[model samples]
Target: MTALALSHPAVALLLPLALLPLLRTSATPQAYPSLEPLGGDPLSAVFSWLLRLAGTVAIAALILGIGGLHLKGQTITKTGEGAHIVLLIDRSSSMDNNFAGRAPAGGEESKSAAARRLIKDFILAREHDLVGVAAFSTSPMHVLPLTDHKPALLAAVDAMDRPGLAFTNVGRGLALSLDIHERDTSAAARAILLVSDGAAVIDRKVQETLRAAFAKRKMNLYWLFLRTAGTRGISEAPPEGEPDTPQAFPERHLDLFFKTLGTNYKAFEAENSAAVAEAIAEISKLERNPITYVENTPRSDLTGYAYGLALLCMLLLALAKAAEVRIPRGSPA
Candidate 1:
């Protein structure tokens, strides 16, 4: 469905049931409904207890009434609703492995294929949102332009089927997304959704350049880290009968860089294709607060109302106490 077709301010339906207590009587009224049976002992403690009970019920009713009113008054208006999204995908050799999730035992879906499956799902689901695609291997490449053209985007995703060891370039990928977003005349919210299996093989200078560019443009960063068990055809073993010590891939350095980037970026760790799609759906709904609301975040003002009701309860208690004092003990007047 198109994002525009989706409901705004998403409704959270709540049913109020506590108001019923307000209509109930303060106590199990004696058949005559009065304290006459207490020997008219106005100072009878039972009368005071009844008054306090009534006050407690009244306060509860007030709280329920206020909650219902707030719910009824809720409003969600679309301010700058049509936003632009950039999808950054990694196409390194590790993306060609079988670790994502064993595709049914006999299936032929490779790792990149599975990731593309997720990309397609996300694209198809976003009917109204403008989207762009950038694929990163040795460097970032703009495979698709920013547009609402679903078919083109899907085709592009399906076409990225390189099966060799390619280095990752996250910084360049992000820079490309920023460039595309700059072209838009009225982008409501410019955001970058990066999907990769950890770090890039780019230099620090390039990474800094991308970061500065994004900071200057005031864009939000969303990172998705697709996990990998390891790449296929990689042999960690030594010659037969030969002793071998474990050696980490040079990519470990790249991993550290991404860890730092992920710290500042909105990150998602996708264990498999299904998770990737789900993450996209969730991230899409994350609404950035309007810049104007930056100073004072809205807060629920139930405290004042609660205090008022509490005071009413205290008043009821006092009245009940006074009535108890006037009544005589054990004698009907």
Candidate 2:
């Protein structure tokens, strides 16, 4: 079943041109007494019908040639695999300093710089994933929306390569990060990657909101904590012969809170750039979910074929009319 589509459908308004021969009468001069001789001649009747058929066919082909008829089709296909990932970064003032508690020198990258570099690599590594960026300091900033456009996501990450504010509003940032996927209707997997070194106490209401958001979807939560030298972090261990001391560091307590959020959650404490790269590598492994995409084929033109057919029919008409015979009227014996 093929469908014909016209590029300029309005051109069909000239369809009445094909019926011109049918609407008008054409008279042929004939020598006859009382017009009875030609009416009874079988050969004359056949010639008249043949002439009309040829004229009608020629008119139809010409009209269609001008009208422009074509067939168009579209297809949607799915291929490869990917997920929707949101990078939630912390931009507190302390993030500007290197993990060694000193300003970065000799081109040494700071914690935030390391995270940004690694996150950019993570986004580029995925082939079809929709990646977004969100960073927070004293407040939440929506840097980018979820999208499969890699350059825009990478550029948005690079834009945050400046100084940070004083506060670290983790709760609000996390809450805003959840909103990135709230209205998603795609089948792609969802995940939030948090890159931060310090932790701030979240308000009770904010905590409740985050908890509800986590439970509302099947989302993966990964925290890539930048652990400065000689500072306690989310993975703080107890002394020998003692139980685990999760409360020893504020980040550890935050880790505990995330553990209770009823989602697939994991925390990695990276002490250096190498560790940061490793953490992102692990994340790349987890983002192997299958994704789908659509490809469109270019439209093909059919007007040329219509015009050729019209020309061929007109040519045949010319040959048929040339074969017609006529006798001299006054020379008959």
Candidate 3:
């Protein structure tokens, strides 16, 4: 239930003025020989009391209106088909290149640009999802907290395509994303949407921490690998002569690490914008689960309603006055 509040509590001090109508009579003074003749006039008594009541209501309502009545803001829990998603975006310098691994020219779109466009669309399509955004290059940067606010989410997605740093620090980025999820206590379907064009070897200690974190929380992990031409894919084996190590084959090793985390993990290798869109659509389809999210309602003003009641009461009083019969001093009672 919404709670009632007043903007100016001092104005409520005038509420006692409403009692004046009951204490004092509004009828004009008239001279009469005796009160015995009107002793059984119950109908007239009822009408008289009704007018006083109307006056009291008008005064009280006006006072409340002046006091600025309103309903306090409230947060409500709502159930819907959505997930708590953290968009872990890559902001490496190489992300600015196209799928062919060159700077965007003519109609070609950079990997970051395509990711931004598709992710924004994905966010809009999931109306009830609680989304947070984080970007990582040299370090993980928390862009936005988990929220259902669409405008802020769109703004965060728009900022992802900005010029990026030199390194792709995926370990710290995943840790930050896990921390974001940890801060939220909502019991909803949780997922991490990792968008990156390249991979970096995570430190051994950081990898242990990530493994522990992933084990503690059962979450869906999605890696949207924007693969450039002639580059290694997540599942591609190293060349016959090359050693198969994390340093030599980071993407494949990262995929192997995610699989070992024992969570629902999937990797999508998109070579262009269309492929990225298709992958996003698939992820959107997989993350559909019943979720209970919090929705906040802002404070609502009730001053106008109070004033409207006062006006209604005044109109009743006006009608009563118009219907009243005036008896002259010398006229028969």
RMSD per model, one decimal: 17.2, 6.3, 3.2
Q: The CA-based lDDT of model 1 is what?
A: 0.60
Best by lDDT: 3
lDDT per residue (tens digit) for residues 239-317 in model 1: 4775432223323444444445533356666666677677777776663433211122233444455457657776775
Stronger candidate by lDDT (2 vs 3): 3
For model 1, state the Cα shift of residue 332 in Å: 99
**Considering every candidate listed, which one attains the maximal TM-score?**
3
Q: Estimated TM-score per prediction?
A: 0.50, 0.67, 0.87
Compared with the true structure, what per-residue lDDT tens digits does model 2 show for residues 110-133? Answer: 888888888888887787777778
Quantify all predictions' global Cα lDDT against the true fold. 0.60, 0.78, 0.92
Give Cα distance to truth, residue 181, candidate 2, Å. Answer: 0.5
lDDT of 3 by residue, 17-133 (tens): 999999875666667577886677889889889889989999999998899999988989888888999999999999999899999999989899999999999999998899999
Clashes of each: 14, 1, 0
Model 2 is weakest, by summed lDDT over 10 consecutive residues, at 24-33
**TM-score ranking from best to worst?**
3, 2, 1
User: In model 3, where is the ten-residue run with the lowest total lDDT?
Assistant: 24-33
Residue-level lDDT for 193 in candidate 2:
90
